[model samples]
Target: MEEKLSKEKIVQAAFQLLRENPELEKLSMRKVAQKLNIQAPAIYWHVENKQALLQSMAEEIENHFVAPKPKENWKETIYAYMENYYELYQQYPCAIEIEIQTIPSYPSRLRNLDAILGILNEAGFSIELSYMTITSLQHLLFGMLMDSSEEKKLYNKVMAGDDYLKKQIILMKQYVQEHELKNISESIQYRQKEKQKDFFMKTLRVFLNGLDTFV
Candidate 1:
């Protein structure tokens, strides 16, 4: 007997496969079908191709992200919203990569964006500025998250007896120490290797404070 494959089921299988193997470069629809014990044609019936499959996987991951309830302090609410997805993307490693590669019109994601814009609009920002501000914040966050992931990978490599990180850090410290700029060397020594969530929260606070000047 052939297994019945609904679009929802296909998306779910694809998500599970991604969770197991997060590299988008290696993902395939046939792999997803294998995970579901179904034929590739079955998956293709619901999702047309690889791009569609990736978008479907993105949709499935966004299913867990909730737009925060409205709060009296909309800035705080917006921070909370971005922080939630930031952390969610950290969990779903393929999330940002897929999001970067595809334009997924996932409903929940759109609602979250709308809610963020709503917060800014309520806080007296014009619609145009609100859009720019939110996108700018998102761009900053994408950079940070990508950096954090790279940092984690490097740290893991160091743990695995790779002296490449050891050498690189030593060289970095040497360069900082040699830099004659007053206090720059000292600041480098005290650099923060903060957990990503805490780091982003503090960064977001500073960013929001800066936005106040625009009001």
Candidate 2:
């Protein structure tokens, strides 16, 4: 008798593919099967389609998070949450890409959201405010993580300098030279590095500070 293919195996294969190529747009089910030493039809038995494969991958990633125990202080809880969240995704950069397309209907994500909502409410936020707080942090993280990928894309595009709408490239090069600035490609590369710098803590501080007056 043949062993049945498992969803975990399929997701692991897809995740390995993602590690090699973070561009989610380029990922395909057939490629995942090749990685797994299985037929593409075998993958279909596990995941109905690519979206389902993504949802399973997302669930695997979200399930890694171990939320901190509630400290008496809500601010501390919030800080701890963001710190843990950032570190978790840092290990799986492709997980960030998985989350960008659609929010996974995974229990882990929903549980984490519920816990955070409860924390915000306990911290004196109104129900609506608590919901908003969780949502705001989610979006902030999404944008922050996406920024690095975006800068890389721009850098890749500009590397084809001659192909990049010749007039704009020439003008940009002239402006940089005139101002003694780094080339646009270099600027984008620098921003990519800057994105890796410690940013989540500082950003959370600023956001919470704003909450001081608003909440």
Candidate of highest lDDT:
2
Q: Where does candidate 1 stray beyond 4 Å?
A: 1-3, 161-166, 177-193
Q: List candidate 2 segments past 4 Å from native.
A: 1-4, 156-197
Worst 10 residues of 2 by lDDT: 188-197
Put down candidate 2 lDDT per residue, 41-141, tens digits, no spaces: 87887799999988888888889998998876887789889889888887775767788765658889989888888878877899878878887988888
- Write the residue-wise lDDT of candidate 1 on 48-126 in tens digits: 9999877877877788897667667877788888887887887776677787877859897788777788778889999
TM-scores, all models, native as reference: 0.84, 0.81
TM-score of 2: 0.81
User: Which residue pairs clash in candidate 2?
Assistant: none
Measured with C-alpha atoms, the lDDT of residue 107 in candidate 1 is 90
